[model samples]
Target: MATVYLDYNAGAPLRPEVAAAIAAAWAAPGNPSAVHGPGRAARARIEAARAEVAALVGADPAGLIFTSGGTEANAALLAGLAVPRLLLSAIEHPSLAVAAAARGGEEIAVGPDGVIDLADLDRRLAADPRPALVSVMLANNETGVIQPVAEAARLVHARGGWLHCDAAQAAGRIPVALDALAADFLTLSAHKMGGPPGIGALVLADPSRQLASLLLGGGQESGRRAGTENLPGIVGFGAASALVGDDLAPDGPTFRVGALRDRLEKLALARVPTARVIGAGAPRLGNTSCLALPGLAGATQVMALDLAGIAVSSGPACASGRQRSSRVLAAMGLPDTVAGSAIRVSLGWASTDQDVDRFVAAWGELAGRKGFTVSAPQAA
Candidate 1:
């Protein structure tokens, strides 16, 4: 039995090019903040990586600030902004609303398609007169549903509010133009895009505009994020970003991966009697399929798939294998029966047709089994 990994949303496998870049960086050791000759070389390397990462999203290199990952970047943005209120989409990642009440933040509603309701956003913005910050993810990490970010940015700006778009899952899958999206702030994670883990960025559309520092002591990241940069991780991230730049075309690997996802979804729906998709009505990432089986528990499905050497997920990877309902689906108004039964199977650049075939065959076999859901593993 061959093992198939379909959980790209959790973290994509490190690309060989990224690994090579990281290895090359690791061979040399110098703090980017130091003033010696080695330090100057390190700084030059970091700057080159910065340009690649910035170019990936059509952002100015000066506007990009390197951070530990998406989580820290989001926390910094949320904490740094001096807004009197924060309004986030109901389907945003937990990082956005971790301290909703304490930070004077409230969730904007989303329709059943898992898409942000612009009317609701406008109403909420109009309902409040204070300076506000609105955070909406470009694409959901779980359902992979793309949000109306450009439209939402218009609404946010109409009321003098800044918009933050989390593009962690969207950057490599789709084209991300800072000006086209009209986002004031955006976030990206390298691990989600075939780079090494523990590296990501927070982009400011305005390079000259200053944000408060999360780490108080250093002049790193333009005094915004205070720490010596992770050179190897950043280099790996840049390599991954550059790779995405090459393949994000209609006739590239992205298109083939999308075909794999569609084939898997069509096969699952045809073979499984109770199969359903959570955001089938909405435009979603080409590589993700949030398939649901009405009577099966998501955890059980996850465990069953694992047994067949097929990797999938109940929802967000942050759930960390917990047997709980999905907040994303809940926000979309999905009932517990449907929400609890959904599993996410996300593909990537390295995925293949064989992987899709294996998944469909395994899933169909599981659907035909009796009492397969019982006595399943509790954790991924």
Candidate 2:
């Protein structure tokens, strides 16, 4: 009865190296901003971590601002960027979506594959002559479908608009280059990549871009994000980023994990006639599978899986206590029932074949008990 954790998208388990780094950093006692000897030592540690993190995304170390987490980083960008109008994809994370909405930002629709509509973006940009800031996620949190961020950036730049990419879900699982994506701003979360949960970063492509400070104290993070840095968390984040090297390669850990995800989806679809994999047709992250069980509620399935000592989730873990229909699936045009019944099963670097097999067996038993026939679904 070993427990299998499959909800990496929520927050990956902390890596041993990251934990060790955190422990070491916690032993130091000096504010990074202080000019004293201990402070200089602390500042050096923070700068080293910054370099490690910046390298992961091909960003200039000086241009990266450490924030509390992905949410704060996103909030700072959405609020601080000097753009008259903001446009974001409908499938963006709640943090981005809520921040955009609060600023009276409009949403660009995503297609059934959960990919942003480029034509709609062009039209929207043309319809409005105002200087705009476009936010599009690099990969979807629920379905793991990768977006055409580089292409979107080209469009945004052509129209004199800046492109901001939320790469929280894509950073460690894939190769994310700020230059390759051509994003003006990019967001990264450490917790999503097996690092400490309290620290994340906002990467700026241009060091000269005007960024209004979100927090106005201490003048930390080059006065872009004010506040004392989370030393231990930043250390952990750096350790985790270093370990993610080449994991996004074809023969890397991520590719193997994706194979496991595909196997799980294939097994589920074969055992439960009504089960379908959402966003299967699109290019998705190797470690994520969004399974929709037509007649079963996602909450019910989540609880049942938990009872079996398996960890899975209905949607973003950020929405834990307020479970509802997945906005991501809905944006993909799934009906309320289908979207509500969808559960996301995400793998990680620590995932193995046994975890996948155990989940499949448990899910099959549950589906059988729910009166679902064991038959393969017809091809779409």
Q: Could you estimate the TM-score for every candidate? A: 0.96, 0.97
In model 2, the worst 10-residue window by lDDT is 371-380
lDDT tens digits, residue span 42-154, model 2? 99999999999999998899999999999999999877877899999999989989877888999999999999999999999999898799999999999999999999999
Candidate 1: count the clashes.
0
For every model shown, the clashing-pair count is 0, 0
Candidate 1 on 1-380: residue-level lDDT in tens?
Answer: 77899999999999999899999999997899989989998999999999999999889999999999999889888777778889999988877767565676788999999999999999999998886899999999889899999999998898998999999999899999999999999999999989999998999999987788888888998888887789999999999999986678879988888888888887777777467877989999999999988778989888999999999889887776578889889989999999999999999978987898888878877877843332221111
Superposition error at 121 for model 2 (Å): 0.7
User: Residue 148: error of model 1 in Å?
Assistant: 0.5
